[model samples]
Target: MAKAFASQGDTSEKNISFTEIGAGIWAFTAEGDPNSGVIIGDDSVMIIEAQATPRLANKVIEKVREITDKPISHVALTHYHAVRVLGASAFGADQILMSDSARAMVVERGQEDWDSEFQRFPRLFEGHESIPGLTWPTTTFSRSMTVYLGQRRVELMHLGRAHTAGDIVIQVPDQNVMFTGDIVEYHSACYCGDGHFRDWGQTLDAIRAFEVDAIAPGRGDALIGPEMVNKAIESTRDFVRSTYQPAAKVAAKGGSLKDAWNEVRAVCDPKFSDFAIYEHCLPFNVARAYDEARGIDTPRIWTAQRDLAMWEALQN
Candidate 1:
């Protein structure tokens, strides 16, 4: 291979930050790693997007402990990705919630994703053995659902497909803060292995319509104030468009996947080369963009073998 496969070369630990974006809403971020949201309600707390394993989830729990002692009532998974959902067991919340589509994806390719992700980035899965099995939601809603944590109202809604088919955003009406799983990233690359490039922008539009005050995004730093929030949304939109446009054009002209990849790199590198996980996510993003442009609506399941095959092919 030309370089390390995915993030295998990334072994150094990142400094973790727990920032309060709203009155009781916290964003747990680690450099550019996957993030988790903490919503402290009047009586209890609700967590959004569990980390990859129990060991990592404990980091978020430790931060949550610094604020309040309210028992975690619910763990809301924004999507069905292994890096996000596999850590649900660590929370032990009374209710593990997910969108109906997310639950179905769990049934469809949960194990495959776990295996693929673990192999791609071992640093995120520090304590892989601790993850009992595929995490399943205790409850699921089709479109949207409102959960009142005491007096706090948290709304989970599937605005549209972006990061994944089941991606959902958590909105706090009172504070006007939203926890957008992987739909909106701040100075970080969007991992689009299973993303819907066509629908991603529309999803961002739906979130924009809310005009929220702050957002605890899927990765990078927490966005506070409208300036930072809008910046992240538009940058994310640019990242997605920059990645897809070149690849789509290549596919439109009956170019090979390698040709599409080179074109995508030519366009995306100048703008997003410094983004977190840019190199790790590029190949998969290009492959999916090519597929989507070629009329593949649903993303194919990525297994460990497929990940290696794709990486090797792209390396050449």
Candidate 2:
């Protein structure tokens, strides 16, 4: 039998957890669905990473209400993926912020990403009709942008290119807690379809420099202590290396995509087979890695047609 396309078969709803990882900070995480972070400023609220749609984002809002009634003043996008940004309208945020590169991505391939991702993971796009078209950033910053609610400060820093050219991390310097959007997923597969493997490693190193007591990663449970935080970082780095290296080696040797996929699977499955979205991400991850290995610096846009063609060619 041919494999299902990406996460199409994952229809079961995951249990959502709204965890208070720091004094006024929280992580809204579902089993492995896209995660969002809440920073409760002294008088207002700031959300990091919106859910896939308005309806889904409402759920996060509900959780936020349970704690405080501060209106959501800002929404910070870690990158320019449809699942992460299309839900901006739900927040009704005063301003939507993203890195300059992320804004460029939204301009370049926003439509293609929306179409392809919607087709690939229907479950994630449950409230498809509710999405108010493409999410746009009202504010764009180059390297870092800092927002303060009262005396509480949250810094959005584009440490470097990793998951995407515009990946950003939200840091609560006072609390030593960071919300790493897709930059570091704990016990979850890093979706590398639009990633930079080589630069991703360097980004991880830069993230490690911060004295983080806790980290709310892109997926999985929140890391509460330094030990767990380091483990998640290391796990993410290991997965990035394991996936990219094997594929790059095969591609450099003039091997086919199938050959590269098989090579990576052999090494990754043993260690990461149980990780969330491991199977769903393998094909696209390998495809990008293969391209990068062959000197393709920019990742090609993934249209619905390309998604199916790649899956058909490497159906396991």
Candidate 3:
């Protein structure tokens, strides 16, 4: 079960669960909550993603301690989202790894994003001051990097651009499990503020090409079996299409952004009524999808003021 809380105010769920996806992989997920994954090896451990702050990371560390006594050796950041990468120091890993693009995003807007996200989501950053600094990747790879935790081999690869320019997936070949950052959310809404919709579908295809039986997405429930695995993929696809087509039609027809949002809200709200963070994601998704459909090359960086402006414009 996933326990959820939507920031500090409004609605939230509790009792999040960490499901063991494979022999050494465990996923801590809450409905509408940010996710963190742990991979324990024979003598050491590698955490897939870190929570937003040390306060939250401690809770995850406590969970991992209950399962293994091995020290956390590496922290692999899937992308550079503040909620996902800001708390790198909490794990106290030997190394933190990420793709080149993620590092670039961090350098470009790390401070802005930190301020922006903290304002948007307060509960996730319970102890904001504990953060050491911007979570820069100690080790960075252009496309792929492979690490051997003792004898276990874990391959980290950047499939393509979908969620963000630097998105990566953690693949455990032996375990047949892939920890997909925000590329393949299961039962969780795609926060497409900086996403590539058409390209995102192709990225999902790239992920499916891998022979994965289990997966831990950026948020929401873990995909335990093959059936749920397929369901998550298909559901993500549906969510993408449902979010895009409406926006595309409006954009292509010269309709306003507000019109596109209305179209997306009308179509998606009913289908994804139960998805996590559906409301929070709607405004951002519509904004990006509308831009992509109109041929905007890169997503406009989301700022604190812009987020409020967009929310106020669409939510009413």
List residue ranges in candidate 3 displaced over 4 A: 1-8, 11-13
What TM-score, over all chains together, does every model reach?
A: 0.99, 0.98, 0.95
lDDT of each: 0.93, 0.93, 0.87
Q: What is residue 315's positional error in candidate 3, in angstroms?
A: 4.6
Candidate 2 lDDT by residue in tens digits, 1-316: 5677758988999999999999999999998889999999988999999888998899999999999999999999999999998988998899899999999999999999999999989988987998979998999999999899889988999999999999999999899999999999998999999999999989999999996999999999999998999899999999999999999899878999999999999999999999999999999999999999999999999999999999999975
lDDT of 1 by residue, 24-70 (tens): 89999998999999999999999998899999999999999999999
What are the per-model numbers of colliding residue pairs? 0, 0, 3
Error of 1 at 23 (Å): 0.9
Clashing pairs in 2: none
Where does candidate 1 have its weakest 10-residue lDDT segment?
A: 1-10
* Model 3 poorest 10 in a row by lDDT: 1-10
